[model samples]
Target: MNGATTSGELRAHNRVRLLRAVHDGGATSTRSHLTRELRLARGTASVLVAGLAEDELLHEEPAQEHGRGRPTQVPGPHPRGPLALAADVREDAWELAACELGGRVTVLDVRPHDGTAEGALVPLGETIAAHTSRLGHRVIGVGVALAGPVRFGGLADIAHLGWRSVDVPALLGLPLRPAHGAGGGGATLGNDTAFAALAEARRGRLRDVRVGLHLHVDFDLGGVLVVDGRPLGGASGTGAEFGHMPLEGGDRPCMCGATGCWGMDVGANALLRHAGLEYGGGRGREQAERVLATSEQAVAACAAALGRGVAALVNAHDPEVVTLSGHGPELAERAGETLLRACEPRLMAIRRDHPPRIEGSALGWRGALLGAMESVFDVFLTPEGLGRWRDNHPDQGRDTPGRRNVTHSTPKGDQPP
Candidate 1:
C-alpha cells in the first residue's frame, strides 16, 4: 500500500481545487461558497485561502450584507495575480485581451490589418510587446486563436488570407516574455473555431453536453467536434476542418483547392455570393449584413445550406447538442424554421424523431478569446504550477503589485513535459 498523503501534498491538492473553484465560479465566488463547493472543513478552507493569499493567487473582501445574516468574505483574483493574454486573429482584423483568473477579460487592443499574413505580424507583435511591458511579471502565458487550420504548431492554410504552411511562432515572435510553465511563456496557437468550441464546452450552452459540435459562421463556416468538454484534435492538430468537407455538390472551386466545400455555401461569403456581390475579405461581413437586411431569399438559401451541412455532420458524429457562434446565432434566428426543415430531409429517419438541440452561443464572438485564456490557465492553475508560484514568492508578506520577482525553474514531474 502507498504511504499516507503528506501535509505538503494535501496542501498542494487543496490549492489546485480551490483555485479551480474560484475560476469556474467567476467573480461571485465567496469563501463560504468555496468551503461548501470543495467540501473542505472550515479550518482547512481557511488554511488554503491564507496560503493562496500569501502567494498572491487570490484575495478576499467582505461581502455586502444583504439580509440579517452575518457578513462573509468574497474571494476574487489577486490584483497582482498572473494574467493570461489572449489574441484572436481573424481574416481582416485582430484583437488582444487580458484575462484574470475568474474569466474577466479586458480588451487590450483591437485593430484592422492588411490581408497579408506576413505583414500583419509586425503590428501584432508590437501590440503584444506593448501589453507585456505594462503587465510586467503578472503575465502567465499567451494564447493565440488563428483563423485557419493549425498543424504542427503553425498554420497549414488560410486561403482567404492567402497563407499556406506558415510558421506561426516565427511570424508572431512568440515567447515575448518569461512565463510560469515551460518553454518561457511561449504562445499556444489553435484554430479559432476549435477554441470557440472549447469555450462553449467550458462555460457556454454546451456545458451540459457530453458530446457536441460547435460551428462559428464568420467569413466562412468553421467548427469542431467537442468530446468530454474538450475539442478533439487529429494527429496533425487540425482534424476539425469541418468546413473543408464537401457537402454541397457543385463545380465551384473553393479557396481550399476543393470543389463544393460546405463552407463555400454556408458562411458570410456564401451570403455575399447569394447577394450578387464579389467576395471581399474586409467587406464580407458588411455585405452579409446588407443582404440579410434586404433579401429573404438569400437568407433562406444560406440557412438551408447551413442546416443541411449540420445534418450531415450530425449523422457522422452523433452529437447530443450543436452550438453556433459568430454570425451563426443571427443566421439561425432569421431562418430557424427553414433551417430545421432543411435538416429534416437530410437527417436519418430515426434521428428526425429526436434531433439534437441547436442553439446560439452564449459567448458570441468572445468565444475564441475566452478559450485562449482557458488554454493558458490550464497551464498555470495546476498543483505543480501553484507550488512553483509559492516558491518564486519566498517573501509571502509582500502584497504589492510590482514587488514580486519571478524566476524560471524546470517544471516538475506533474507538469506537462
Candidate 2:
C-alpha cells in the first residue's frame, strides 16, 4: 500500500477497461466514444487502441464521414481476436457457438444424440475439437451448459439423459489452446438454467437489477437468484435447485427420487400430466406444448403451481423482479392472471401490497446460449488474464499494455491545426 502505482500496471488496467467496454457494450466503439466512456484523454485512448490493435485483440478502421470534427477511428473485435466458446448439452442434443468480444455469437454446430454420456459429449467434443483447432488461436475457453446439476469437477447427474456421476472430462479432454490462453483451462460446467440466468443478468430481462429471480420452465422448472449480476451457486456450487421444493404439498413423485416436488406440478411434465399424457424425459416437450396451446385447464393448473413456488421464493429472497424463460412466456401469456392470483394470496402481508413484477424472458432460448459464452468470457477478459495473454504472445505490434514503447508526445502542430 506504500509504493506508487507502476506505469506498466496502470497501462494494463486501462487496456482491460477498454476491452471490457467493447465486450459489454455489445458493439463497436469509436476512439472518441471510448475516450468519453473510459474518462481518458483522446490521445491516451488512441494509444491504448493502437496497442490493442498491435496485439491483434482489436481491429481498427476509418470511421465513416458524417460529422464536422476530425475523422475518428472505429475499434472492434479483430478478425483474429480472442473468442469465447460455449456448448449446450441438452437431453437429446448438443450445440456449440463462438462469440466475439462484443457478445456477437455465431452458432457453429448442433447435433442430436442417443442420450448417453458418450452419445452427447463425444459428438460435441469432436465438433469443438474440429472448430477450435482452426479457431484455436482466438479461442479463450469453452463453457458447457448442461440440463441438470453439475457438482465437483467431473460428475454430472442429468436425469433426462439418465447420466449418473458421469466423468465428463475423461470423455472431453482439453478443447483448445488459444494463442492468448495458455493451453486453455478445459470446459467449465454450469447448469443450463443457471447459465440462462447469467445471460439474463448480463444482457436480457434481468440486466441492471440489483437482485433478480430467473425461472426457466421447460420439461421441468429450475431457476437461480442473481445478486450483483451473478447466479448464487451454493457452497458446493450445487445449489439453486429451486425446482425440487414442494410448494404445492402434493404427494406426487419426482424424478429426483423426492416426493411432492414443486417441479412435478409445473413445466412440460405438468402440462402433459394434466392433459392425461405420460411425460417422460424430455420426450413430452412438444406434446406438452400442444396440450397447453389447446387445453386452457392444463395451462391454468400449471400456472397455479408455478405461482405458488414463485411466491415462496419471493418471500424467502425478496428479489426486485422475477423473469421467466424456457416455455414460461407462452404459459404466462395464456394464464397470467391465474398465476398472479395464486401468488397474491401466498405472499406475506408486507410483500402483498407492493409485489415484485413477474415478466417474460427477453432473450428466450438465446439466454442459455449467450450465458454459456459469457461464462467463459468472464474468466478470460480480466486485466490479469489479458496481461498474461499479451505476455505469452509477444511480438505484438508496437506498444503492449504492460510496456511503454510508443511515444505519447505529440508535436506542437500535430493537434490538427
Candidate 3:
C-alpha cells in the first residue's frame, strides 16, 4: 500500500494526468482546450491545474487570446518534479536522455561502448545514476531502447552485440521493488524500434492517424503495425520484424540467422555496404549519410526492398498511413522520390486510389525517449494505481479528478526508438 491519501493526493493524481495529456497532445493546449481534450469541465480543469502548479508538475499563465468572457490561462511545461529517462543502444554506442514529463528533453549522456557484452549494462546504469543525481530523488524508473530484438521481459539478442541470452534485468542492476501483485513503479524495457513507434504514435507523425505502420531502419530494421492507434504486439511482441523477411534470392545474410533477409537488403548496414563502407565506429554513419547524399542508388535499393516488404503488408493489413521512424524517415526525405517510385509498382494496382501515405517522423530521435517515459508512467498512473493511492491516502482522493468510469477508446498513437 502507498500509505494514506488526503485531498492533496487527489490533486497530485489529476495534475499528473493533465500534464500527461499535454505531453501526449504535443504542443500545449489551453485550459479550455485541455477541458475539451480531456472531456473535463472547466471548473475541474482549473482545480487540476491549481494542484499541478502546487506540485510544480505544471506551470500556468494567463492566456493572451483576444476574446471576451472569463479569461482562461494556459498550462505550460512543469518547472520541476519527476523526470523520464530514455536509453538508445546502437551497434557501438549509446545515448541516454532525460525528458521532463512535459516532453522537453536534455541529452544526459552519450557513450561509445561495445554493447556486445552483458557487462556493458553496468556502465550504463552508472551513467544514468550520475546523470539523474542532480535531480535528487525524482527519478522514477529507467526505460531502455535496445538496437536488437528484445525477447520477453528478460533477454535481448542482437548479433551486432554478439549477445545471446543476455539477462538484461540483472545486468542493469535496476532497482527492483517487491512485487505487490498490483501496480507500482518498476523498470520498464522496450525494443528501441517499438519505443520509437510508440513515441511517434503518441507524440509524432501518427498522432491522429487511425491506422499506420512505423518502420525503424537502424543496424537492424524493425517495424510495428498500429491499428486504431494501438500497436499490434501480436502474440509474441516480435510482430513486425520486417528485416527478417526473406528478399527472394538475395545473397547477404541477416543477424537474425536468416539468409537473404530484408535487413540484409535494406537496413543501415545494407546501405553502408552499398556504399562500399565498413561497420563499427561512426564509419557506417558517415557512409550511410554519404550513400543518401551521393546518389539514389543505395537508397533506391533500400526503397525497393522496403517497397516489396510494404506491398506484402499493404496487401494483407491495409494500414492508412506508413510513418517512417529512425533512418526510414531520413531515407524518405533524401531518397523519397526513389522510394515512392519503387513503391508505385509494388503496390496493389487494383486499389491504386488509396495508397498509404509514407512520410518521415515528426519527433525524430525524441520519439523513442518520450515513448519509453510514457511506458514507465503507465505502470504507476493507471486507474488501479490511483485507486491504491486513494485507499492509502483517503483524504487526498476527494479533491482529485473523478474517473469518468466511461471508457473512451482512441486509436494508439505513434512512437520511435
Candidate 4:
C-alpha cells in the first residue's frame, strides 16, 4: 500500500488548483475570487499566490475598487510565464497566434495557403520558427488545429485538399525550442471543429451546456460532440465525422469515399453548386461568400440542407444545444426560421416541440485558436509539470543544469508578459 499524502504533495496540488482557477477565470480573477472559488482559506490562497509569484507563473496587482470591500490583488500571468503557440490551418489560409496563460491571444501572422497540406508545411514551419525565435524560450508547447481528420498524430485525409496519411508532427517539425517542464514539450494536433467545440465548452456558449453539438461550416461542414465540457475524439483521434453521415439519399460519391454524405449538401460546396459555381477545391469559400452576398435562392437551399443535417444529428445524438461557428452562424442568422421549419418534419414529435437551441458561436473566428491554446495548457498545467517547472527555477540560487534564462516584458492588455 502507498503511504499517505505529505504536506509537500498537498501543497503542490493546491498550487495547481489555484493556477487552474486563475486560468479558467481569466484576467479579472482576484485573490478573494480564487479563495472563494477554490474554497480555500484566505491565508492559504495568499500563500499559494505568493508561491506562484515566486516561481514566475503568476503576477498580482491591486484590483480596482468596486463596491464596499477591502482591496484585493487580481492575478495575471507572470512576465516570464510559459506561453503557448496555436496554429489553425484551413484550405486557403492559416493563422498563428501567441497565447498567454490568462487567455490573451496575440495574432502573430495570417497568410494565404496553397490549399494543399504538403505544400503548407514550408511556410507554416517558417512562420512558427520566426515566432518561436522572437518569443524565446518561454513557449511551452504548440497546438495545431487542422481542417481535416487527424489520425494518430497525423492527417488521415483532407479530401478537399487531397492529402492522405500525412504525418503532421513530422511536417511541422515541433519542439522549436526546449520546454520549461519535465514533460519535454512538443506539439499537439487536433481537428479544427473539435478544437472549436472545446473553445465553446470552455469559454463560449457551451459553458453552461452538459451535452451539445458544435458545427463549423466553412468550405465543408465539420463538427464534434461536446459532453460535459469535453469534446470526445475517438480512438486514433479522428472520430467525430458528423458531416460524413449519410442523411441525404443520393448516388454522388463524397470526397470522404462515401455516398450521400450530409456535408455534400450543407456547406460552401452545396451553396456554390446551387449558385452554378464550381464546387471542388480552391475557391469554394470565396464563391460561396459571393453567392451568399448576391443570391438568395442559393442561400435558401444551403440553409435548408444545413437544417436537415442538424435535425438528423439531433435526432441521433439528443444533445441539449447546437452551437454554430464559421459560416454556420451567418446561415442561421439569414435562415434561422427556415432551418427550424425544415427540422420540424424530421425530428421526433416530442423533440419537435422542444428542439435543441441553435445559436451562433461566441468566440467567432478565434474559437479554434483559443482551443489550441487550451490544449497546450492542458498538457503543461498538471501537478507534475508544475513541480518540474518549480524545480528548474528554485529560489535557492544554485543554477540548475539545462536551465535557460528567460527574460520578461509586460504583455499588452491586462495580462502580464
Q: Candidate 2 — which residues are off by over 4 angstroms?
A: 1-4, 61-68, 175-183, 391-417
Q: Give the count of colliding residue pairs in each prediction.
A: 0, 0, 32, 1
lDDT of 4 by residue, 83-119 (tens): 8888888878888877777787766677887877657
> Which regions of candidate 1 are displaced past 4 Å?
1-5, 176-184, 280-282, 393-395, 399-417
TM-score of each: 0.90, 0.88, 0.82, 0.90
Predictions in order: lDDT: 0.80, 0.79, 0.65, 0.79
12, model 3: CA deviation in Å? 8.8
lDDT of 1 by residue, 1-417 (tens): 223289877778788888988887775777888899888999999988887888888878778888898688877778778788888989888888778888877777778888787767668877788778877667777888888888875654788778888877788777422112444366878889988998888889888699999999888889899999989888888977898888877678888888888888887788888888988554566778888777788889989999999999999899999999988898899989999988879999778788999999999899998888888888777776676666665456775353222211222211110
Candidate 4 — which residues are off by over 4 angstroms? 1-4, 175-182, 392-417
The global Cα lDDT (0 to 1) of model 1 is: 0.80
Global local distance difference test of model 3:
0.65
lDDT of 4: 0.79
Query: Any residue pairs clashing in model 1, and if so which?
Result: none
Candidates 1 and 3, the one with greater lDDT: 1
Range of the 10 consecutive residues with the lowest summed lDDT in candidate 1:
408-417
Candidate 3 C-alpha lDDT tens digits along 325-381: 777777777666777776777767763578888888887766666677766655545
